[model samples]
Target: MGALDYVLAGVAAVFLGPEMFSLFGLPVSLALAMVVLGFLTGILVGATPGLGGPMAMAISLPILISLFGYSADALLPVMGFLIGVMKGATVGGAVPAILFNTPGTADAFMTTLDGYPMTQRGQARKALKVAHVSSAAGDTFSDIVLIVCAPFLAIMIERFLDLPEKTALLLLSLSFIATVVGGSAGKGLIATGLGLLAAFVGTGEDFYPRLSFGTEALSQGFGPAAVFLGVLIVGELFRGIEDLWREKARSGQVTQYDLSGDQSLGWADLRRLAPHIGRSALIGTAIGALPGIGSSLAATLGYTVAKARHKPGAGDPKMGEGAPEGVAATEAANSAVSGANLIPVLSLGIPGNVAAVFLILAAESIGGFTPGPSVFRFTETAVNPELVIAFGLFTMMMLANLMNWTVGGVFMRSLGFLVRVPRQLLLPVVLLLTLTSIYVETPRFEVILFTLGFGVLGYLMRRVGMSPLPFVIAYILGGRLEETARQAFAATGADPFFLFNRPVALALMVLALLVIVWSVRPKGEAS
Candidate 1:
């Protein structure tokens, strides 16, 4: 096909979508339906404290593959649902943080600092509105950038970056992630190393599996779906249940509340928050482009910047005490990350955060698409199906943003009744669902045990103040990194110092070294 033909085809793929059904005499694609479902599900998940975007994605991944089939044609609809969940979850997370004193997701922790205080002062509705607007606007901005940048960056990487450079870039990404993903670089490095070790088991081209230790299941390798669900979702679920027990023991019943807050937000309110939202969106977009760094940092940095620069308006609540701008600032930054997190995933096959890790899993499980520069290649001889899926996923995110604008307020308000649901009741249901989802993916009981082992490891890691993110991301990238490094070595004739053969590779390694040093540097030394 010609360029125009491809463009038209891509546009059609995006709008028409796959998995169609009739809706009142109109044919509606499941991709479109998923946008709505995913957004509503996001609200449900994000309004509840134990769930997050990754957990939603994890639970849906195997089920989506089963429904859509492991064909290239299934890519669009599955990806569409995933992208929708991502956008919706980011927006919905602020709801609980505003309505109750609890944050629904890790990234929403900052929102609670200002949001719950607003609730205490009878501005709960206003806080929710600010959060909703900022989240939608910021998400839209980031999605636009993803639309423009993902393709361009993919093309650039394809054209100029050879295997050596790619390998080095991957290394740099890992180095940066290990250093900067969370506090205590030593712990981060340890977690990442453990991930790499775990991922290597039963996975390789060699006749003898790298780390399987002679077990049949280990030799076969654990699927990403199993590992991530174990580490991210199940692990968090375990912790959440423990937390619920503690909460139940501490306070059997919680205080009830009436919605007495001023729910109205005027145009003046929008004007007031416009600057903070804009600044944080841009900041979040930039951060999202980098590999491994996550929305929590984006939210924190945005809140920090807003606090430093903001001057309280006369008779207006201060930013920290209960300011609506504080909600906007926090939400916008975290929401902006929803799109930007895809940049590396779409362009270089590097997942930027936990959510992006599931996106990779979805793409892999559904088949027909691989997330990398190759996926973006324009082949005139044949149709590039992955590109079409990419466009379709992009469309799904926009639809989600539109949903956030239209029905999000009603949904958040509706969930006000659920803000105080007993966690003791809630967590058991989540655990059962998680177990069922995993069983659906693999009928084997041992797989469940293996996953539980990882979950226990994850829980202990968190209990000891270590971040699980680095471990998850590192595990996902480890085998790929090894494969690329081997390719580069083979290309350079098996030299031990093969990376030194390319100046670009050498420079990238140096950069990685510098970033590791900077990330691990002591706070006292810096001061």
Candidate 2:
């Protein structure tokens, strides 16, 4: 469809879709309001140290559900808000990494390697601006990919995939995610298996409680939002607090950035980063389309590849030493993965990451739409053209990107002001906001207790050098794995060899076993 056509369609969807908004006894446009609210919310969540995009989505889902009540009008705006947060968070993570040597998200860890050093060298503002621009460019390009490619892929998957083949495809996707993410094959398999186990902890569809430990609350499948926020957001809060205590003991001076210098990107910088941006974007998009893989993996792989291709002394001044290219490569790849991750969800009904899975849930709760190939079919009848939603989402992303680029530098500069504020003031604010958001979601004081408990668990896990990604992934995928296993068995009448009989399924099973073996092998051994 033409650009103008897409725009008009999106405008119509925003106005006509199902959402309840009333102002002064007149009907208000909820989709437009959601778009605006989502952007602001994203900025708030992204600017916070512990809260990331996935946690934001988890917290927002139920609120949107209660407010909008499962209308297409309601769903699109919420999705738009999520997209804003995802994009904003991707850039926002760099702020803490640059100023305090603390990575706000896993994807921003690489930023710390260079960013913190630059801060020590008194170039914090420049580094922060570079990060913002590069991240925005990468994210904007990825959204473009989502606009162009997702629909075509959806059509193809709808035409070809059978149940057994689809199952095999999922296995392949998971294995690939594990291998690419684990640092080594063995680590990856271990992480993936661990994640699967964590996912199995609460309850299954057969009304059977698997690992509830006899607790009534535990019997009702573990809330994904709780685990996600606990492990990521609350866990980081504890870490930040501990760091505060150390800084207090040492009487460390809080370093602040001077933003008086120009923060705008020049054409020369863009030209230098162009190739790396392209390469990382391609890598991220491909990785994101696969289930189980995520932006972290894409960022790491992109950085590694960029480092390997560097010419002698091309990294002179050091590659990990405040080089904008490093930030560009990592940010571009990770941001691109955000868009690509949606591909599998929108097209094939499979989630590519924890965030996408939550998005699927949100879509279901708000739109009464099951996320899969069939969504496109239903869009043609039950709602406006499917393409309209896609276009609207892309437009929202573009708006979010513009906001990130223009306001991100200002936001980072303002954070420098926070350095002057005492930790006593900052910590309480952070704690209060977190508690309030969590409480609003569940209304249970026990949830706060659980969050604190998980925070300790998360901190301990980090200290041991064990990757939490595996656990999180397993926790997210556990229910689906169990359901699929049950379905496969039912189809085979409990025949153990049924999986082996299907060529595609057998191939996937073999691949999964091989991945385990290969990952377990010595580091020097070839897969």
Candidate 3:
């Protein structure tokens, strides 16, 4: 098929595929319906304290899989829902931060800096509008980059990279991720090692499970649902519960702000904010294209740069002191990361953030799709279903963006009351819901225990300032790394020094070493 044909096929797949039901003589594709549903759900969760996209994704994945089964047909709807959640959550997370100074995630904390001050000044609605506009604009820009760049990058990698080179590339990715993710390179490496260890427990070409210790449950290893939800969701729940217990005596009431004044985001306002949004969008997109560096850093950098550039005239508010540009800069940069983060996942099969990780998990679980260079292959003789799916996914993202531009602001503004929901009351309910969902899927009591164990471990790791991101990424990619290394070794006829024999592979490995060295160096000593 031709390129145009492939594009058309993908568009058709999303708009004309399986129907949830007819909507007034028009067919509403299940994927489209799921996107809408997930978008709304995402906003709800993101507006609430102590919940965000990853948490929502983790809780919903098992249920979606159970409902859809493991078929190629399930891919679009399941992934579409996830994509919606990602976009909606990006927009929705600013609500509480702007209204009540409570950030649902680390990135949103940057939004809260200026956003809450706007609330104090009775311009809360104006701040929300700024956030919504900047976020949607940044996201739209990032998606455009993803659509244009991922295929070309994948094609280049496919054409140029051999197995040993691929193996080295994976090593470089891991090294970079380990170095950049957490507080210290050493701790990140430790987290990565633990992840690799956990991933290899029951996996390999061995006759018996490698680390099973003769237990049947161990032989099967850990389920993805258990490990992912445990570390990402349940672990956070543990932390929240502990916080709630410690702060139980504190007042639960939130200061309510009246929506008043010039809250409209007009054309002149858009033009004024466009420069900040554009700069942050570029910054965020660049950061997102790399594996493992997440949106929080992007938000921080965006806010810092905007603050530096912002010059307040007499009688005007300074940046971070109720300036709308602060909310715009932070929101745009962080939201932009969501779309561009998919670049690594689509092109290299490497997830860049937690949301991308779940998307990878969904594709892996469904069995028909595998994300990587080959997925973008173009052939005249046969249709590339993966390419079609890629375009379909892109369509869903654009659809979500459309929703964001049209109605997301209204939805987000309405969620101001969510700030009043006490964390003490909310955390346990979320905990119960997460545990129940996991149990329903696994149907084994032991998996729950294992999940709680991992959750405890996650909580401990967080307390020590060790990020769980490296661990999760390492766990997902470990098997693939081993498989690629094995392939490289065999292809080189058992050559022990095969990597060194290939200049590209050798260079990549050296680069990986340098990255670790650079990362481990003292901040004062480094350039």
A best-first ranking of the candidates according to their lDDT comes to 3, 1, 2
Colliding pairs, model 2: 18-73, 185-519, 186-519, 195-474, 196-474, 199-475
Q: Score candidate 3 by TM-score against the native.
A: 0.98
Which pairs in model 3 have colliding backbones? none
Ranking by TM-score: 3, 1, 2
TM-score for every candidate vs. truth? 0.95, 0.79, 0.98
Q: Is candidate 1 or candidate 3 better by TM-score?
A: 3
lDDT by residue (tens digit), candidate 1, 244-350: 66766585454544567468988988998999999999989999888777888899889999988789968877878988888999999999988998999999888
Task: Return the TM-score for candidate 2, rounded to 2 decimals.
Answer: 0.79
Give the per-residue lDDT digits (tens) of candidate 3, residues 19-56. 99998999999999999989988898899888889889
lDDT of each: 0.82, 0.68, 0.90
lDDT, candidate 2, 219-329, per-residue tens: 765555566667655666677788776777676466555444354568976887788878888888888877666777788888887777655345344558766677777
Error of 3 at 325 (Å): 0.6
Clashes of each: 0, 6, 0
Misplaced by over 4 Å in model 3 are 525-527
